[model samples]
Target: MANKNAPFHPIIYVRGYAMTPGEIDETTADPFCGFNLGSTVYRAVPEKERQPRKFIFESPVIRLASDFGYQDVYEEGYDILDPEWEADPDNKVPSRAIIIFRYYDEASRLLGIGQTPNISQFADKLRLLILRVRELVCKNPANGIGEDDFRCHLVAHSMGGLVCRALLQNPAAEFRAAVKHVDKLFTYATPHNGIEMVGVNIPKWLDMNDMKNFNRDYMAEYLNIKDAFKATGRVDWLPEDSFPSERVFCMVGSNRMDYEAALGMSRTFAGHGSDGLVRIENAALHGWRRSGKNKGSAGDSCAKAFAYRAHSGFLGIVNSEEAFQNLTRFLFGDIRVDLWVDVEQIRLPKPVQDEVLAGRKVSALYQFEILASPRGKLWYLTRRTAEEDSVACLSHEEWMQAPAQRQALYLSSVFLANRARVNPRRRSLAYSMTLGVRVPDYEVDRRLWVNEHYEGGYLFRDSIILEMVPPKAEGDAWQVKYAWQGSGVSKADTAIDAKLLGDSRMEVCVPFGSSGSPGMQGQLRFIVSLWNKEAAGN
Candidate 1:
């Protein structure tokens, strides 16, 4: 039986964009099921080993758009392919992609199918499809019915991620709400940012043709292309504006095999740091912020919930274990938080220390969010298995103990070494460093929950306190004090004097070792103030 206070919930896995026949095949192709659903690669083998396999080919239900008919070289000059140019050589070639959904039973067996054409019409058709799926599942009797009726998980690949993102961010409140009913989303090789399809510059004449035929005003009526284009912005996979990252789990491939292809492109749009097509930065919610530190709001609470993983290639990303782990974890974790910590101290380059005299001031602390249960038990979520009673608790020291973990800790450093290497201000010696926020809790919370309420309310009323020990120089001791200025304040600050951190870290707590409350509702402020041994100013 689940603990009375546990809050465990079932998970729904949502996968991302899968290119349709139009998007991938020069001619019309079938909706290609990603490697996770099992590849359609017809493996040659011995005649004795031959056996029947589940095949998903083109669905007769959907028709190909005439404009999408195949052609040789693209005529469009615009960086992005516009649908109107598919027919004319003078026009830019359209990016052919597909949309298909396959429902699965609880046992993970394919149940039914739904397919749609890659129309220029914004998500208008996709919105209707979401509603139709809801209605169909609820009404049909042969469709294995259950109390958890809304069991569909949207699995998209490539451009399909963009389609799903549009669905999730639909202005139509009904459509947005309907899509929320879907359990989860899984995406593979989705260029959340615009994909670089062999970067073709259209002739100046094609630009004029777009103004005449595929003009924003003209396509706005039936296709809503203007808004869709606006939402996708430079990034075709995600909307131009921010999205709720929490609900979605993005899988990004970091392989940069097409380095030569991406060399001529602008730094911002270059896919050299991406999976042959989409950049890793774009695969995540664009306006991602650290959970606790206020960086202004992206306006969508649900959107804040998402997890991302890095793998090698476009096709390999979907078929790899990393993708599967990220997908399943996002659908199942119990504690979710977007955490980011800045290492201002690391900015010191050794020689410059005497110039400033005192150690560099920490403009921002190494911050990470804590998504433990109401009962202050992080162990509930971290435990390895059901039979295990304890889970490994990670402090800043343990977290960055390994090289891989340390590298992850210094994200800003990582980005700087890669595509973000250009120095903006050489004359000015000072440099600004920022690290990408890690939805650290998302992997642990959504994926590791024993039930909906992490460990099924095992902790009851206790609140968690998270502390990190930094790697500081020996004998250069410092004291750490914590304070919170939220709706409720603790009676006294918790002070740690010991060398809790081997280097330069101090212990910090959430809810700050305070007494339990009737229920977990109010937000508590947590501050870790550092003081010198001489009791000088912090």
Candidate 2:
């Protein structure tokens, strides 16, 4: 029997888009669609000359079953849709099961009359499917699961994420009560703001063959969101009141070159700052604000992470370890921390300051690199860099704004498993994070500019070490230790200071400098707090 207090729940996997008829036919032919697809290779660095390393992942479907005791509901090559299958007299379904929302089956020639429905239709079907799953799991007494305790997590990839959103957001859709059954939603490379091709939003006028499903205007209508056509404005794709944004996780893909689709034309048209298809800016659901006037609004911020994987294929975000770790941790992990960097001051070089003092039009672009690794692990839990992955870009003007009101750069949402700690008996968690500030190039007057001597394109960087120990009993304060790398021969060689600020909240200032040199004077304000797990609905 499963642990009564355990957070383990059923997971519903939704696959992505199938562009062509052949692709749809091939997808329908598969038993698990793309959820069963696994990869044996990965590239540590996004370089053409570097060969990918051999890392075997037994797919999400197999991993969930092998690692967590989750099972598929099929029996002897028979699916729930099979006519011969009937409900057991006990009215029980497995506590942990995976249900693939085969929304594209009817579009395939082998299944139906090759007629595809719009996203709204798919969402309507999703509502019914949730009801079906609830009946199979909650209503069954033999499962020993209560109706109030029955909930499932939705894991979707690409356009399938939009389908999940529509089911939860669209008011016109039937089966409204089914939305309550969804506990959490995780999306991989979803275009929440709609896809753009060659710097153009796929025109809404092109409705032939359901091409308009990707149009922002058309999506707004079906997803029931307001202000979808705002080109340079913010749009909230997920409804605010329907579900808490904290329970939603968006896994963004940054490596565009590895997505070998459409004879390499897909990457060409999608351009840079994307996962070869969805733009990095558009990949996440909206309403997440770190600062400014909208800081404390309900459903304002959702958890998100950036990976170097592409949208799909061998290097796809869904098939990578980065995505898998994030998925499993978000669903099962107990501890959470939301990190942000507030720029207190940005000191420029003497020459650059002189140019600005002389009324010369000068602007510098800075990219923020972040990497997090747990103790006793060589691989990073999350990585965002300038060269190979998602980099937060800001201009000099943006940095000089008021520090309090200025928007804070979101670092990463770190989730640590209580049982997976280095020393489980100690009830302590240890992790190190490195933040690199890079000024790759600057613009004097919106022109191509290059620095004469650039060392690895980094202007400043720092690494932080954090150790956390939550209180075992209520009313007791939590304990945390934080230390940063100081200038020395090595991190261990330096006399570091580990400070404890109260219990739940702490503030620290990390000075940034170049590699092996300490002169580029700038400091980043870090505000670390223990995320409210109860309020987050975890």
Which number leads on lDDT? 2
Per-candidate TM-scores read 0.40, 0.88
The 10-residue segment with the lowest total lDDT in model 1: 410-419
lDDT of 1 by residue, 1-538 (tens): 2111111112122233322323223111222233323322221121214552333212111111222231222234321123453344333211121224422111121221323333223255555555544443434443334323443455565555655655655556666555555555556656554434334322223333122112223322322234444543332222223244434555555444322333524223433445444554444444323234533223232222111212222224454333443443344332222222322112222333232355432121123222221121111111011111111122333333452422222111000011111343321111111111111111221242122222222211222233222224455544333334232534224554543443223333232122231111122322222221111111
lDDT per residue (tens digit) for residues 336-375 in model 2: 6666765555666666656668877667777788898777
TM-score of candidate 1 against the unseen true structure = 0.40
**lDDT (Cα) of model 1:** 0.32
lDDT of 1 at 198: 38
